[model samples]
Target chain A: MYMVAFLGPNASYTHQAARDRFNQDTCVLSPQVTIEDVFQQVQSRVAKFGVVPFENSTNGSVVFTLDLFADIKSRHPDIVVCGEAYVDVHHCLLGRGAARLTDTSLSSKTDSPTSSGQATPTSKVPYPKTPAVKPVVPVKHVKKLYSHPQAWGQCRDFLSTYLKGVERQDVSSTSRAAELVAEDQSGSSAAISSAIAAEVHGLDVLARNIEDSADNKTRFFILKRTDCLEHQPMHRGAKVVDDDQNSFKSLVSFTVNHEDPGSLADSLAVFKSYKLNLTSINTRPSGLVPWNYIFFIEFKGRRENDGATGAVNAALRDLNNVAKCWRWLGSWESEL
Target chain B: MYMVAFLGPNASYTHQAARDRFNQDTCVLSPQVTIEDVFQQVQSRVAKFGVVPFENSTNGSVVFTLDLFADIKSRHPDIVVCGEAYVDVHHCLLGRGAARLTDTSLSSKTDSPTSSGQATPTSKVPYPKTPAVKPVVPVKHVKKLYSHPQAWGQCRDFLSTYLKGVERQDVSSTSRAAELVAEDQSGSSAAISSAIAAEVHGLDVLARNIEDSADNKTRFFILKRTDCLEHQPMHRGAKVVDDDQNSFKSLVSFTVNHEDPGSLADSLAVFKSYKLNLTSINTRPSGLVPWNYIFFIEFKGRRENDGATGAVNAALRDLNNVAKCWRWLGSWESEL
Candidate 1:
């Protein structure tokens, strides 16, 4: 079986996307500690494909992924984005299944105000509710909350209303948080994680879809080494159905002379001439100097025929002449 | 005194930039918990000015700051980027001054490999060589290394070479990491933080400039309320010297119909027509849908007069006509 690496211990949003994008039967899912690790795994040929979070609908670009792409020309030249998968990020509040808990619905919305005049709940006592039904922990009963730091901001509305004054701790990932909460002997600890994470760690889902935004989603890129593209079996979930499907999108990174007027516009104009519809544009620090940026442009286009100078090839050829330096990240089958 | 809010407890990189950009005697420094807190303070008029990290040479853009700018139109419409400051990020390994420590220089470079074949150090005993020297904790004795998540990547070389196998803990900020190490009763804990953070938290610097990159720098934006720009006294460090100095750069955010080909190119053409040199371009998720982006363009230009259709004003007018929607983020004097 081919190894498919993803950012995970287990049950992260990236893991979800990876599972959704690749066939588990033919590809063994390997969990990596970091996004860089995933790239390193693919670069070393330890994994046939690697998945990393690219962007979030609410949080914006994942800088780690963008920075890695920025250094693609020098560091991981053989690596290319092959496909993409998106996972709707629905955060869940998780706790020990056996813990005594209070129903948040039974608690009053307006708790007693602290000296600071904010509604700070001072009580940690679990108000027993539906004891005959099942033992579940209340958010108010939890003395501490654990999750990835990003989760706190995403679940601000749910947190402030339910668990005011609770100590929020940052873990390596949301899955790790659930794992920690599961290992905790004290019932007072809980975590903001995914429902799948709760299941993997054998914890109970205290709340579902606790994120502030309804449409929170994270996009992940499926990456593979360019030289190993051939002799690779198509994963069942991959969208590469045909060569002429007109469903391909290309990503190109380039730098322009900052001192030249309209240099950026001139580079972008090449896309117009090629009739490639522009979908997205982004920039990242070049790391060589302050204020220097590497611009990445994504557009609807066809993959270049090998040595044939196709439409994308023609555009990139023109772009290379216009840009100070350029690198084609990849042309992948667009999911949507 | 004008209140200047920054992302800080005391000595984060943002706090250092805030201090460097504003006169200490004329401005009262107020530390905020998060970047959003700094923006909220400025928007509520609690602070006249706010400082937040925009991008880092190593880490790319700070998504927290970018996401805030994405919603500037509806959330903080009055906030504007008035100035910018750059901070040289020099990380230091800090520990309790009273702790017994060893000199890392005396330790052997080659450590024992773990069962996994990775070179993981098995010993935590402090090798005391500098008995006559200052009491500095050795990295080998550190059971835990605390810092912001970004610092780990920045100091990868240093960490792998000197402090391999040390457990890393992520805190809210580097300064907060220093504060945690200071408060830790266990002498085994150390922190990777700023030099200023060590001084403020009464921790001894175990190592200096531990970051992997020599050119690692963070850029911060100095923000102010647009309505309060008139009566605002000239900050001693601000670069708003003259209106026609050609040092001004404006940041504008806009969106175009994705179905419309060459729409982005047309919007960018307006800058070229007005003779505005484009310096940088970026995009953030519009938050409305997946794949939809809000493009931000920064260029050399002057702020528009109240009623005069200046070069920038005319260019923006044209851009607005071409774009589906647009918002002028700010015009600020460029530091570089």
Candidate 2:
């Protein structure tokens, strides 16, 4: 039986993604932390496969996933690439009865016989009593804005415009924001979150598609133990059979000696000379030391591929002086 | 009187940053939107100075802020950078007394003088009297995780470890997630947000410092209309100015025509020829047709320096085809 792992409490999007990708009968494990843990679970054989988000259209790449690859590759040596999946995002507003402005009865208006025994005339204002649909006044009374960091960044333009100068708060998830707004009796606060959050928490969506850009999409990855799965070619135009195909990409993390001027250039030169396409690069300060930095890089080809495999090994050979804590992260095709 | 604009309702970090840089007497306007709007506010003379976050310690640079420089420079040619300020972030959890843990009082051990009032030994047990201290569990059970995208990204490792396989929801801000969590009475839902959010909506802190990194901070920019203020002298000391100096580094945005490989190299060569140290570089796909790309670059020197300014302009002139839109953003030194 295939065991699929995701970031969870059950109602999370990752869980939904996992369920959609795998069969319902497959056992799904919901951990309380991160995608890295899911990868670890699979590495430890606790789970057969793990699903995680790697990037989003509106927000760019998921840095943490890249960081995780950095961490894993440094420690593990055997993981390989598998597949890829793309998912569309649709945002909606859900809320309790109080937040709804349009009464359902008003939309479903139909003349019918009155319970009092008189024939109801079409002019008599249709069926169930229609509550007045009040115009949503743009009140200058908003005290706070709530949402996930990504959503906030995407809607930064809008928030700065309409809700300018309001208290902007960060939350765990959009759904949690909806929950808080729904529970609060005070109408001064609003949540900038997903429609599902509104539905779960029963909170009205005061705004829709408030993001600065509309091409919002997210990509998720399915990671397995490095030893468990071998590389397989899944991309079109590849002639390699399932047994010899390479599916996962290679990720590496290392640090350049801060004192060296050409350290970064030298490291990058290796890839360029090898004709390797570096997909992503990120730098973070080493918390333990002042002014020191660590770099994370993602390359297009996999370690199992002869060209990529040779370039990485060659780079390692030359980095005897500058590189520190190098590792190879596992590769797998994500099931979206 | 200088008027400073920021994203707000009130008590926003951006507002605080503005107030910290400019005097309290400087008229502050809260506009509820993006940094681009702040530039617009300054350009239109709605505000003399506008403040917006350009980067965070935990997150890298703010892409939108970088994108705005190109847009504003093309439309309003006069705006220039004046100063910068940095601020530290400390998030707290707050709520009403009803949401606080209940304190239990112990009986006095001393004997009373009156015979009717018998002395009782104090119990050794320290127990809370009210049930408020008990973990406020939800009703429904684990379903989803919610938070701002950045917050989620920051706390990704933790979330994946503990909440793996659960649904993940993204909101606009962390405060929104906290607000939503407060409204949820269900037993399963949880939010990864700030302590301040917990206080505002009367919610509990399920976790604290959930972010993977501890030194998380954000940087804000102070901008003025091109025609509003005179150019200030650039700070030339080896050490970068602290928050009090109100000094800032310059930001430049440009686009390289997609026709050739040497285009980007040529632009960089200009900077290198002038001995200019490039601090950072980020490239994004321009939404425009023809598959062009936008590049945001940050350098060590200020635009006010004649040699630095002349070199940049000369480079742009030499490779006219390489740069389609070249403009300098504000130069306020960051406060954090």
Candidate 3:
């Protein structure tokens, strides 16, 4: 049986994405401690596939994933991205015996900022003069909140509105936060975690979909060894469909001659010449020096058959002349 | 006294950078709980200046800082970056009653990776068959390691080689981690924090400069209200010397016409046309909609006098035609 690894203690967002992308009946799901562990598992052939978060719509790029890719040419060179999965990251406020928000009015009210389509900056007032509408859950009873650091940012509106000035403690994962809340004997702590984590840890969902953005989504990269793709087809149960732009996507990382003026522009010109639609661009510390950078460019194109005929291939060949160094990270079916 | 807000509980890397950039006798160093708090402090005019981390040499950009800028044109329009400070981040392992690293051999030994100059990927083996040299500290006594999540990635080699299988707990900041270790009654926890944090929290430095890269530096942006800059001069005693490049650096953020075929490339072409050297480029979710991005471009040029004569002014004028919308974030004396 094929084994798939994900960043998890279980029920984390990555775990949910892994389950969504693989058929449990055919593939055994394994939980790795860190994103690096997931990469190591695939690199060492311990797992046939690995799932790691690429970015969040609310937060930007997961720097850990990008940093790993920045050095891929030197380390874990055999791994390649095979597919992607998107998970709606709806967070819940979980606590021991906290009221399960049965009132639909609260969810709709809290989602007002999202519906207005304003990128609402966090309110200046921590406790905004206690809204006239009474909270279903007694937030004043809670003395501490627990979650991964990223969750605090995502739930900014909800937090500042109800639970501002409360002591917040960061844990390894949101699931771990839920676990800590479950173990707390004081009943004064709450956690921002997934509903599944609440169920696993036997905590009540005080609130649901508390994320400031209603459409908070996380993108995950499904990875596998490049050598294994010939025998192993795409995962059996992934539901990623080709959108209207039915084209393949490829990601490449490269460093231009920093000392030379216009070196970066010269490299970017190749993509335009190839008529490739650039989807995203990001930069990371090259790890070779303090200020030098490695740039990752994702563009719409195909790398099938690994030959020189494709536009992506041609652009890459042309890129070699302008870039001091470059590496093709992967090519996968486009989901945009 | 002038107040400078920073992201800290105190003794954090941000605090160190703030202390280095501001004279405490003239400017009061205030510790804000979060990066957002620091921004809000400046936006609310509660503080004359704010210090927030921009990027780390080992890790990349701090997304929180970038995300705040993603919506600056709408949210915090008055804030502008006036200067930047670089802090050499050397993490120390702090534990209550833990032996100080009196032996200098370990420091010299770990320096091998930095000296070799190869972007050293993490070793495959988690516990590499115990080294012949005895470790200075008793690793078996430690049950938990505490640090900010980013610190873990920076100290990967050291952690994997010596502290494999130890439980790691994430905290709000490295200083908070040190505080936790100092308060731990079990004496089984150690924290990765700054040397100043170890001294402040009354913890012994089990290890010094434990970060994988010898030159792990963090760059911080010194922010101030745009309106206040005209009345007051740069902070009392920031010793930012003009570098040999002797050019001014400006940061601009914009959203290109996504529907246009070559809108982004055309927008970038303006810099080349103006002969402005692009220093760095980054992208963050625009927050207006899912997958829509705001591009931040930092280039070496002058944007003084707020008129249309300068090359940067002319390029920005050209960019206005190509981009759907744009904002000039700031201009400051170049440090590079």
Candidate 4:
């Protein structure tokens, strides 16, 4: 049986992604932590493979995931990204009851049970506890909004304009927010999370399509510990069929050592020379040193099958002296 | 009196940033919402200037602020960044009481009140009325861990390793977490927040330096609706006329239409031709369109000064058709 691991709390988006990419028959492990933990799990053979979010069309790159890749590549030379998954994110407002309870004892004496009774009259402001699972909050009693940082930021305009003067809180994951609101007896707080999270936690949907952008999608990766499937096809149709199947995409990350003029031009020349179509290119601080950057590049072909692979390999080999480090992250299609 | 606005709940890092950069006696307004609110406040003449975080060394660009600039330039043409400030961020774990509490409830049903009486002889759980903060039970018992998304993310390693199975809840702001934790009588909850927040809410410090990276610092912008002062040099022998006067580093943001491949190249060439040294460059998805991007660029020169002003004007004139929009953000030195 294939062992699959994902960043989780059972029903996290990453878990959904892993299930979507890997066969349902595969044994899946959900680690309640980060993508780094997913990598570690795979590295330690706790799982054969792991799924982690790498980027979002809306939020650019997931820096932590990239950092994890860098750390893993530096320490463990065997791990490689074997598959990719693209999941469209539609954030929903999730809460347990109809309406959120506002005026939750703003006074400092709330800790005292005696004082809590005094604040209940003011704190008991009932929000309409509509049981419908609509994604949109028609009436704006949303005083506090909970979401992942990226989700919160993507919906900044809507929250600022509609939920004006309301509180916007950031959580580790959207699923966590959904869990919080679902368990919250107080109806005043709502979480901006996934529809699945809302379904799992039985949260009331306040608002739908709250994101400023409609095409909000996140990309995830399934990385293997031993580069077991490195010889897979580069561009095998859009679908995959196997016992433990996953769609594939090319993932490459490299460091540009020099910041001089035309440094980017010379680097792009390698891709251009190989006729490779780059889907995305993002530069983020290396975290290892100040001002230095790590450029993550996503493209159309897998690292093993396409002719572009040999070209890229040759280019990296030639540039490796000046380039800090370069490697293939993963190529499998992500399940979502 | 120069009026300045910033994101706040009082004593927030943004508030300290504005105070450090602007006039010592400058009238300050702490808006409870987004940086866009600050821009609107300035444009509406409610405040003469605004301060907002624009970037961080560890986190890269503050894309939300950059998006706001794009909106401000298109909708309200009056406001611009007049100065910049850089501030260090230090996160702390806080709770209520003196010594940290290790375990608060013996059973999961601590809310039942009656469950508190049915204590098992082997369990070493502290009574609910311990009066001091303690390490919450693992994820199995933890109801919630409150904190800002960034704080939670920066401390992901610690949370994953130590708190492992706990439910991580997101709050609108770290300060809000402290407020909630102060009011929560439940012993299974705690908050990761700033020391200042802990002090305000009368909570205790549970942890220190929880961030994965030690060199975390955020850069803030001091913005205004109208130009308030002309840039001047601070010579070593210059006479000090007013002790309340301030100096700031100017930040300007503009976009080059990427509809054409040469557009960005043409626009960037103007900066090169004029010999302007750009300090930073970051790109974000334009809210107006799905794939379109807006680039936020920072330079060292002051737009208020003739040399810098002339260069910017020349660049704009040369790249008029390719230029989407441009604005001066603000300038201010951050307090150490």
Best by TM-score: 1
TM (chain A), candidate 4? 0.76
Candidate 2's clash total is 136
Q: Which residue pairs does candidate 3 place in steric collision?
A: none
Instruction: Compose the digit string of candidate 1's lDDT tens values, residues A176-227.
Output: 9999998886666889999999889888887788786778888888898988
For model 3 chain A, give the 10-residue run with minimal summed lDDT. A126-135
Superposed by TM-score, candidate 2 places the C-alpha of residue A203 at a distance from the truth, in angstroms, of 15
Supply the DockQ value of model 2.
Answer: 0.10
Task: Estimate the lDDT of model 3.
Answer: 0.78
RMSD of 3: 6.4
Q: What is the TM-score of chain B alone in each candidate?
A: 0.85, 0.68, 0.86, 0.75
lDDT tens readout by residue for model 3, B48-132? 9898999988787887898787764355778788777788998877785433334333223343332222233446653333222
Identify the runs in model 3 with alpha carbons over 4 angstroms from their true place: A98-123, A126-143, A184-188, A230-246, A305-307, B98-123, B126-141, B184-188, B229-246, B305-307
- Using lDDT as the measure, the top candidate is 3
lDDT of 2 by residue, A24-104 (tens): 554645544666667666666777767777666655566666655645233323433354556555443233333243434
Winning candidate number (DockQ): 3
The TM-score between candidate 1 and the true structure equals: 0.86
- The superposed Cα distance between candidate 1 and the true structure at residue B211, in angstroms, equals 1.8
Report the Cα RMSD per candidate: 6.5, 12.3, 6.4, 10.4
Better of 1 and 3 by lDDT: 3
Model 3 lDDT at residue B299: 86
Compute each candidate's TM-score over C-alphas: 0.86, 0.61, 0.84, 0.69
